[model samples]
Target: MNPLAHLRPALDAGLVELGLAAPALSARLLDYLALLDRWNRAYNLTAIRDPREMVVKHLLDSLAMAPFVGDETLADLGTGPGLPGIPLALARPGLRVTLVESNGKKARFLREAVRRLGLANARVAGCRAEALDEPGAYDCLTARALGTLAELVRVGGHLLKPGGRLLAMKGLAPADEIAALPPDWHASAVHALRVPGLDAERHLVVVTRRAA
Candidate 1:
């Protein structure tokens, strides 16, 4: 059975239709997943052992956010296995993505993926997002299935620039999370996502800091 035969069509079609797929993007997605699977055995990089799940959850879910962020520098906080970070970077090569991971093992995997994939524009910061000296220095701060609304906003808020957004890939409507933000923060639309070939509850929460 050809692995790419069945899966490529839907993904390629979706990306092209949405204007997200670029040259070599699909190939890199395969490489990225292969590396993750290879390393997971030795390092436990991700919970989803099945490569197919990696495609649906990690790859597709991450790519789903591509259209939203659109051409900006992104910082992915607590990028455990590069869920949305790596895939997002692959989907849009023009975007400068920094994957922030505190655990040395996970960080190493991210760096390995970067080098192997030849992602010159991507960098992996093996440090806590809070410790990174540059505050609010990115056009967007992103996280996928990372934390509670408060915990997510609390840690990731500082990474976004003054007007930059925090894009959280969550399971359902982020109403509770949105309400938790101070009144000053703006809660943009919570767009529902329809990721091809995957049955998962997906939502993209766009947020900004509360004005003082």
Candidate 2:
């Protein structure tokens, strides 16, 4: 029996709250969480150790971005342990996701997760966002706790095709970071996200290149 099985109710409730209730998807999310829990004991891939907290902070928090996602090729830059990338892929099977991570251990974990989860639409980049060579290849890019808006664009901007958007998950509204955005890019929209079971504030900053 999976030790994390007890948290299934919480995960299901959170998914229903997010309007993403699906039995299969929720089960897969739990499987990924169990895998992460197992790996953390040996790799320390993430700091959040409790499985219940992982359902809220990791699974629900990541799936909260589902409504904002579209059917486009997405690159998840600096995806430590495949937060939004993995969950988003699991939620929307048609959306193609590329998990970009430079850390060797984390990258290994990501690849394993993708394979074990049978994520046919997801792949791992296993390189730094800036080092990733597929220029102007993606329709959108996502980052969670990666860096400031400016810093994120500086590193991963090349991955976006023309008119592509960057959906950045941040804690609180990063006004300072928004103001620091490069001249070529602008915050097209800012959405305050409410993750079920989470008490803190979360925001999604959508950025796009300036019209030439």
Candidate 3:
């Protein structure tokens, strides 16, 4: 019952086409999914338990923005089950990812997963964004299924460097939220992305800091 047999082609094609990691990264992703599904039972990490859906909804959906991640450090805001953050980090090993969650149970799960998965670059922070001391220090920040664009920007603004960007993973286009962006920090570019193995509804909202 090797999941990779069914997943390899679609996963490879998706990552390669999306410009995520090389096709080889898919194997690691598959391995990671196995662990996720096992932990999910006790941890209640994610709702979707099916491997296929996990690949499409979680893994591929996260990699849609691999190109934009570039060399900057990334933080996952309000990360509950590590959808876009953990998957994104698994896909792009070179990227630095901080998974922020206020829940003690989820944070403990993430820490255990990071250690067991040998994810040296992935870290778990059990705190609200405002409580952290570092401000305007991150190269990139991300919020997946966290909150409205305005709210995320307001709370997570201090996490981004002066010229860094914020990547928001959303289920639909955020027109009203985009409109409400602060003029100085509004999006400089908005890219409508496609995740190869995921649902068409997936979108990556990129907002870079605009100069005043």
Candidate 4:
């Protein structure tokens, strides 16, 4: 039995549920999953071994935030295996994505994935998130399973332009982390995401900087 045969239907269903009903985009997403699956065997890029689970957890979970992404430059901090960044880039061809990763192997995998997927709007940055010093370089930033809201803003805040947004994906509605946000920043909205076929509680924390 072919894995994509099983995975395709689920992926298609999930994408439609997420309001991404484009057949062409769905096909490209599956291509990314196939590439990730093939590399995982050798590089262990992701801990999720099952392809079906990847469809739900990685693909759908990431795409769940597509509705909230703005059409501008986005920097994905600690983008291991290019989560929301890669998928978002595929969905929005006009959006430029910069995937920042420190690990050599994962960074290599990201570069290869971008090349093989022919994502001309995407690029890989082989460095740590905190080391990025491009103040106001991006209009939006994303971090998936990366860190607390405070920590993410503390390190990646400089990368965002004034009035820019940070979309942080987390398992739960981290109240404590939200409470701990820097005084200069505030939670604009916290959206609870519903990833198709995923029973886990997923939330997208939308944070923005306060004017000086």
Report the number of the highest-lDDT candidate: 2
lDDT for predicted candidate 3 compared with the true structure = 0.78
**Candidate 4 lDDT by residue in tens digits, 130-187:** 8986789999999997888999998899999878999999988999998999998989
The TM-score values for the models, in the order shown, are: 0.90, 0.98, 0.89, 0.96
- Give all candidates' CA lDDT scores: 0.79, 0.94, 0.78, 0.91
Error of 3 at 118 (Å): 1.3
Error of 3 at 167 (Å): 1.0
lDDT of 1: 0.79
Ranking by lDDT: 2, 4, 1, 3
lDDT of 3 by residue, 44-154 (tens): 888887877877777887777677775558888888877677877876778889899898888887887788778888898899876766787789888877788888888
Tens digit of lDDT per residue, candidate 1, span 159-182? 778888888888888787777876
In model 2, what is the error at residue 7, expressed in angstroms?
A: 0.5
For every candidate in turn, the CA RMSD to the true structure comes to 2.4, 0.7, 2.2, 1.5
